[model samples]
Structures are given as structure tokens and as C-alpha cells.
Target: MDVPFDLNSYVRVLKLASTPSWEEFSRVALIAGAGVALVGLLGFVIFLLMSFVPGAGL
Candidate 1:
């Protein structure tokens, strides 16, 4: 049996994948952090609302 994944292809991918610059990395991190914070806030709001519901057992 022969394998389809060639070592040259892996080398090509490694060559193409470059490290993100500081500016690019920071911008992406800020966006991702904002997204996570927003989702967490939304979840917290939902939890508060659910806690107020009667007989829901929290």
C-alpha cells in the first residue's frame, strides 16, 4: 500500500505558513478577546434571567 501524504507537500505547507507580525497578531487577539467577552456577557445575562424564573431550580 502507498501513502498519499508526501513529505514534500508538508515542507511546502511549512514554507507557506509564516508567523504573524506583531500588529497583525495584536489586532487578531483584540478581536478574538472582544468576541469572547461579548459571548460571556451574553451568557451572564441569560443566567441572570433564568435565575429569576420561578421553579426553574436554577
Candidate 2:
């Protein structure tokens, strides 16, 4: 058995999709992604530093 979905429905379902207000959502998502990347880089650096320190016992 198979189910059907009207994927095209979302393309026309929202008047908000074209409004200037929508750009803020995009900006917020970009910033959140960048913040996550920064945190991951910092954590990796810390891990490397700890691994190199004598008897850090990480």
C-alpha cells in the first residue's frame, strides 16, 4: 500500500512566504548554524589541548 501527499500544497499555502518578515527567519537560522559551528570548533581545540597536556587525564 502507498500513501499520497500533495507536496505542491505547501508551495501556495502561505501568504507569509513572500513577505519581508520571512527574511528574519532565514537570518535567525543562519546565526544559529554559525553559533553551533563556533562551539564545535572551540570544543575540538579544547580536546586537542587537553590531549597534549601532560597527565591532563581527560
Candidate 3:
């Protein structure tokens, strides 16, 4: 069996891709940061709750 690389397909994809404007980048960054902070807060809450469990061993 043999496989072939499609260079033209990759080139076409690259041509279609564009960098986000500053406003777009700022919105994306804010949303991503909030998501990460939310996840961290949730994990910390879970950890704090587990520490109170009688047999969790902290």
C-alpha cells in the first residue's frame, strides 16, 4: 500500500486562513481566560470539599 501527500490541499487551506483582528483576538482571549479560571475555581472547590471528608486523608 502507498499514500500520497496533497500539497495543493494544504496550500489552499493556508490561503483561506486569516489572523484574527485585535478586537476578535481580545474577545477570544477573554473568553478562553474566563473558561480556564472557571475550571480552576471548580477544581479548587472540589478539593476543599474533599478535604472535609472523614476518610479522604486530605
Q: Considering every candidate listed, which one attains the maximal TM-score?
A: 3
Q: What would you estimate as the lDDT of candidate 3?
A: 0.88
Q: What does candidate 1's lDDT look like per residue over 1-58, in tens digits?
A: 2345687778889999999999999999999999999999999998887889887644
Candidate 3: 10-residue stretch with minimal lDDT: 1-10
Q: Where does model 2 exceed 4 Å of error?
A: 1-20
Q: Which residue pairs collide, candidate 1?
A: none
TM-score of each: 0.80, 0.56, 0.83
Order the candidate numbers by lDDT, best to worst.
1, 3, 2
lDDT of each: 0.89, 0.79, 0.88
Tell me how many clashing residue pairs each candidate has. Answer: 0, 0, 0
lDDT score of residue 52 within candidate 3 = 87
Q: Which lDDT tens digits does candidate 3 get at residues 1-58?
A: 2233577777789999999999999999999999999999999988987898888764
| Residue 22 in model 1: lDDT | 100
Least lDDT summed over 10 consecutive residues: which range in candidate 1? 1-10
Deviating ranges (above 4 Å) for candidate 3: 1-5
The prediction achieving the highest lDDT against the true structure is: 1
